[model samples]
Target chain A: MCGIVGLLVKKPELREQLGALMVPMLVEMAARGPESAGMAVFTAALPEGQRKYSLHAPVWDYDWGGFEGEFIKRFGPEAQLGVQGNHAILTCDEPADAVKPWVRGHFPMLHILAAGRVMDIYKDTGHPASVAERYRFGSFSGTHLVGHTRMATESAVTPDRAHPFTAGEDFCLVHNGTISNPYMIRRKLEHRGIVFETDNDTEAACRYLEWRMREGDNLETALGKGFEELDGFYTFLIGTQNKLALVRDAFACKPAVVAETDDYVAIASEFRSLAHLPGVDQAKLFEPMPEEIYSWTV
Target chain B: MDGVNATDRRRVFDLSTARVRDLNQFLHHELPGSGVEQVEVQHPGGRHAIAVGINHPVNVEVKGHGGYYLAGMNKLASVTVHGNVGWGVAENMMSGTVRVKGFASESAGATGHGGTLIIEGDASLRCGISMKGIDIVVGGDIGNYSAFMAQAGHLLVCGDAGHALGDSLYEAVIYVRGRIKSLGADAQEEEMTDADRAKVAELLARAGFGYQPSEFKRVASAKKLYHWNADANQEY
Candidate 1:
């Protein structure tokens, strides 16, 4: 059991309050998933010709004094790095494919959470309220965001096991149920030279989508392929740079509610997570049918 | 406002200050007689177990939406929600009536023993799962796996039903006016008799639904799954 929440602000003015509006929704989900909480925010695009990469370490006491000099020496002088809590965001003119491998070789302790133009991922193993406060999430400004509170049904209670798992480039996914055939699917993807970070089933699902998209499938087509291959009771909220999509398994065993209004489109595991959204009282509320993909974009 | 009479004084409970426990405590404090016969609950959204375990005959009107197990183990109390409801709206209810003016989530009346549950809008998955002896009426559609493992009761769906209706059903009777996508293990559609039509008509009228009894179909257990045999194991 887990809680997933996604918000796509239709009005640009509400972007700054995205995190503020999301706090109550995340906190309400504490009952569903008390083990860990995570979020992915899609803010304004990166500066021209620059790419942003989010990195996560176990502790905030990691050395950062020589980080800028090291990055400059490896890549170029156009690199900029900043540390907030246990997360670090690095912006550079180099491509992600070039910087990612070099960063991994230099910083063995750091795990790349997300590397994209508009996405920044933050997560930790703690209560949702405390984690949100620690990261000062209320001040975050973004066009859209996706969050997850994990109950840790199968994986260890580690920060890396937390959700909003990044798929490819700017895509991320948060899942609620388990996949029964993940090992078989993982082997199949591995045979296709697709690398995996964690043994989490959700990661396999995300990577499967990434592989499909890499083979020239759009988000909708990739998801349609997933419906045919994936087996289990699952409700997924996937986030791209411009779109947020929701899909439930054919059984629809997992719960999901969608509320749409003039200002925003919100999706959550239950209505309580969406009860406080603006204009929610007048919003159109309905349960997403099984195997149907519901998506909204900027 | 509508059900209140001259003898019964209505008391308003603001959930902002008084929690759901307080509301239940106020109702259960007096066993046989809680002079307050009518309760008006305000700001009821995001709260669970609003008026559970009520023994006395009272009327509760929730002004807004409700959370899980809104009226579990209720007895002799008529609970009404003006807005939508979360999962298990009247789970294991013993008696009285629970009505929702809006939609209801999964497991609306799960394992209810005896009572009347009415949902004016659609009900999500598992509307009457494992029901023992209750009467549930849904004015709109219901999702998959409804009436699963039901032992005894009556479920009346006015609209379409999703996949796997009455899976592993035992003794419970189901009347669906719209399409049934599928039936679960050991459950089969039976010919509706005159008595079944009368029962369906009465339940629909009681729930304030206008539908012809002739349009409905009855579903019951085939009694083929009560015993196990090695030859029947192939069917498994």
Candidate 2:
């Protein structure tokens, strides 16, 4: 079993300072999932004249600093890559679809996890500090972030098999627990021409959410739809650039503790993992209700 | 039982010799490592995981209290813990004897594939859930939901039973001797005939309890929930 920690601050003040404050809580939760760790921050960035889209590329345990050079080499110098906590934030000069094929062709393992006004997803193998150091994560700014510490069971320890797996633009997911029906779900998704990048239950979970999102559903509704169809134990904390959502399976087999005060809303697999958060009173802890979907945004 | 130490000639240790925690750990590591046949742990402090995962055919005598999961999954060894055990004592055990001289916690022998778990005291709720061929004999009152979904076994509770006893039991014979609060879904009270009385008497004797066989009540499943009907539109 792995651990997942996610925080969605309703106010901008807490959201801007999330990365610095959440580092210790993520650090304490290393034991629940010791194999790998990752975090993503989704902060809305203002643009002029047109829709400002940020390409949320989940760099699968690749060279973070060299991603800019690698992207330029693959898609020519016109494509620019910015850094955001191990993920390469791409702002293309044109619409991202023309370069999506080239990007996929260049980095076969690279997954276009999310894309929107402020889509950000960063995930990798190893300790959070190691993944943080390779990408200079501490300085990357964002408002809301969802994190993961993975203890791999079904898939290999590659970056593609990591959490926060995405499907198309504006769809990102962080998950815990196993999916018992991946093979059946995979075949259905493949028939629909949805390309799956990894052989992970997490990917299936992402595809389930994405398939629901494609059906004109929002994040909370999509996750609620997932709960109805997906079998097995799971507690998912999913986020787009703006909306944050949480969903647990019917049985509540996997553990998830949620706490909310006047200041912030925090959640992890255990109360011990939330020790570093400000004003985490033990009495405030709560287990996520089974088959319930919770979401909040500013 | 000095005869156990003299003729059995197992490793003997008093409270002054070593702590029960160290003694059990030593016996678990060294008995299997050194091929020692039998061992004893005296004056336990309700600590957990004593004699866990012991594969060899050794006889372990644990004296005093214990916490959770005592003698869990003992493959060939016989562990006689001479005190009350905490929750999930002997949980998921396979092929061994766990005899508790005192009370056992909730879900005692839960999901154990195969074992003979004899408890001299009461057991808590959900005891023997999904039990597969594990024979449980409790000498005292059993809490609610006993023998829940027991696949195959004989659960002999010699005292009063709590509410929701034997809920959703499957292919398991439950013989309770005292008053029952309520029977759970899919489970029904059956007639305690001469044959069931004999079986209960034999099980009580095995657990070192001397009780009249006719004083017990037999509970079993009605087998209604075994098959599913897709088209019948039955709510239950």
Candidate 3:
């Protein structure tokens, strides 16, 4: 089990304050998932350039220098490189539609996690506090953010196994349960040449959403498809730079609570995580209905 | 309150002083509305009524792993637990129901004045101890001394019962099938008549257990202990 949280704030000023507020909530849920923690922030873009999708993955065993040279040759000079441990972040200025096909065609061992302008994903092994420290996120600033604290159970415990996983550049997801049908769905996505990073089931969930989006389905529709296709227990929150969505499995085995207001929306694995939110009311305690899919756009 | 009381998170509360001070404080403490939703207690380490006396039409879900007297004295709330509950779950409950999806510790549904208590799994010793006007239906086997001293209402067990069932019972009818190791003082096995079979069948259906009433036997106190006769040196 893991702790997942997401908030869509109406005030842009709250963007920077989001990280500070999230730190306490994530820390309190340390018992739920103790392996790793990461947060993705989405802020409004000032430049309004073409949509960009970026995937950061740690390449292992292979020659790092040779891989970097080959990656630069494949994507050319537009690619920006940053290294963290064995991980590397490759980004480009091209539109997501133009960049995704090229990345899939070149990297046979990579999985795309998020596809959108202003997309950010951070993950590392250890507690949420340590992971946040690794990113030097003294204060996270974003209009909307999704955070995940992962406990490795069904999947191997590694930095790559962390949540807020992205598929292509426009879609990103964080999950709190197991996906029983991951291998089957992975095979299908592999047929489409979507590379995978970790052996985690969430990789299939990411690819599943990408598969639906590529087929011209909207985010909500793809989430609905996930309920029908993905098996096992899951209460997940998926976010892009422009959209936020919630999905519970048909059985609703895992727990997820939502507190909504006209000004903002917040969701978490437990109501206690939302207890410290400014306007929480005990009267609105409700669990998401089983098989229910909720979404919002900004 | 942000969540359950910080002090109560690790402290143990017993049946007499059982209180759920901040039951829904985590879920709806900041929202506006009266809509019913489910709240779960991840680890109920000997805490009572994580949801007791809730005034709203809510569904309180305790994900098992709980302690004594869960859902005790509940009113206007429906509680469903996913695991085994401790002694006296739904005790003194009024105007609402308590459903146990798994086994019960002991004395479940004790002295409940109203509402139905359904135990889908087996019940421990002293099951439904001193039940008064509550309708208790157990799907699986019940341990020894079930329905002992029950004053009123029905105690029905769908599976076999252990020793000394319905010891010194009065008013309440004890229905069980299969073997009984022994009977409590003033309690005895009776004939399984049609009326007894029908009553047991109805309770089984309501408790979501399908059973053949003919496979059960009726047990009740002989009422010899209800009054004192000064005639001989014998006391029933």
Candidate 4:
């Protein structure tokens, strides 16, 4: 089993407390998932033509200053990197298409967790609370975020296999159930020249949906296709540029509860995580129906 | 059953300071002769297995949202949760009444044997799966595949039901006041008689719902898939 937690602040002021409010929710679900924890936070977008590339190194004290100096030497003083624990957000005026290939060509050891104008990803294999502390999750400020705690049923327990798997820019998915036909989906995507990052089941699903979106289907239509093609028990909580969407499989094979108030909307695998939220007693609490997509925008 | 100095008839359990295990230990081990007829639990914080496995007659009120298995294996105890609950609330309950003032997650009263489980708000999927002799009343719509393979019981939903209301039923009966998306295999709707109406009325009254009995429809097993048939080739 795994735990999926998402929060989208309706009030702009609550965005500052997004990570603080979500850490408790994530920690409460450690009972459901204790193997690994990860999240994708959607911060304020950089100006047009700029992007943030989230990079993770194997060591906690990697020399980010040296890496930034090298990047500036190649691309001038336009690239700036902010280091946080083992994770760093490298902001550059270059688009993703330009920066990704260059980073991959130069630094083979650094894992690019995500690249987008607004989203920053941090994930590691550890207890959710400790991982949160390792990444300073309490001080994160964002309009919305999607987090996951994995029990690692189908894949190995590694930081790269941890959830909030991303596809295109600003899109990530965290899953709470296993997919039955991931190999089939993987074959379909790989046959189309789409590369997969890992053998994890959630990666297949994330790549599938994003492939559909790249091919012209919007999020809802791609999710409609996901309901048709993806065969298995899944309660997928997805994060986009400005939205948080949740969808359960047709069988309701996994559990998900949603609590929405005027201030924010919180989605978790169980209500146990949501009980600590502010104004939750008065919030409108309900479960999303099977196969229906519940989306909330920032 | 050691030295507790509670002289009041109503004892309160503050979950903020007291662990759920200790609170349950008090309800399980020392409450019979403790002279505390009512126990109120505060700050439940959505914890699991609160006030479970009670064998004596008592009143337990949970002040806020409870987690999974709020009152499982209950007997002769009336437990009320004033807020929402997580999965499997009052599962495998044998007797007495367990009520939730707010909504419940999946499998609300699964495999219950006796007593009444009432939800004033909606219940999620599989509300009363494999029930035996228990009664369930949902004030709002129930989710998909409710009452699946129920052996013997009465499930009353005052609101709409999602897909496959009763799948692979046995002797249990289902009375739905609102729309049923579909019925499961071998489960068919039958004409509601006066006795069925009276049964609905009694349960509704016991659960304090104001719905009229005439608004319901009955669903029971058709017994088609009861035995092995060699000629059918496994098509229902």
Q: What digit string (tens of lDDT, one per residue) describes model 3 on residues B81-141?
A: 8666656688877757889887776678888777789988887667778888888888888
RMSD of each: 2.4, 10.2, 15.3, 2.0
Candidate 1: residue B176 lDDT (0-100)? 94
Model with the higher TM-score, candidate 1 or 4: 4
After superposition, candidate 1 runs with Cα above 4 Å error: B1-8, B30-32
- Error of model 3, residue A117, in angstroms: 1.0
TM-score of 4: 0.97
- True-contact fraction in model 3 equals 0.00
lDDT of 4 by residue, B152-222 (tens): 98999999998887899999999999999999998999999999999999999999999899999999999
List the candidates' TM-scores in order. 0.95, 0.58, 0.55, 0.97
- TM-score for predicted model 3 compared with the true structure: 0.55
Pick by lDDT: which candidate is best? Answer: 4
Least lDDT summed over 10 consecutive residues: which range in candidate 3 chain A?
A: A280-289
> What DockQ values do the models have?
0.56, 0.04, 0.04, 0.73
Candidate 1's residue-wise lDDT over A1-298, tens digit each? 9999998889889999999999889988988898899999999998777889888886777776566688899887888887887888888898878987887898877898998899999998999989888887788889999999999876898888899898668889999999988888899999988778888989888889878988999899999999999989799999999999999998887888888999999999988788777788898888898899888988
True contacts kept of 2: 0.00
Per-residue accuracy of model 2 over B1-236 as CA lDDT, tens digit each: 33344544567655434665666666666666564677777645445677777777888888765556888877888999876676677888888788998777667898887778998888766678788888898888887667888888788888888777878789988888888888988899889888887888778777788888888888888998888867658765
Which candidate leads the pack in TM-score? 4
Once superposed on the true structure, which residue ranges of model 4 sit more than 4 Å away at CA? B1-7
Report the error of model 1 at residue B101, Å. 1.2
Give me the runs in candidate 2 sitting further than 4 Å from their true place. Answer: A46-80, A83-87, A106-113, A136-140, B1-166, B169-236
Candidate 3 has an lDDT of 0.71
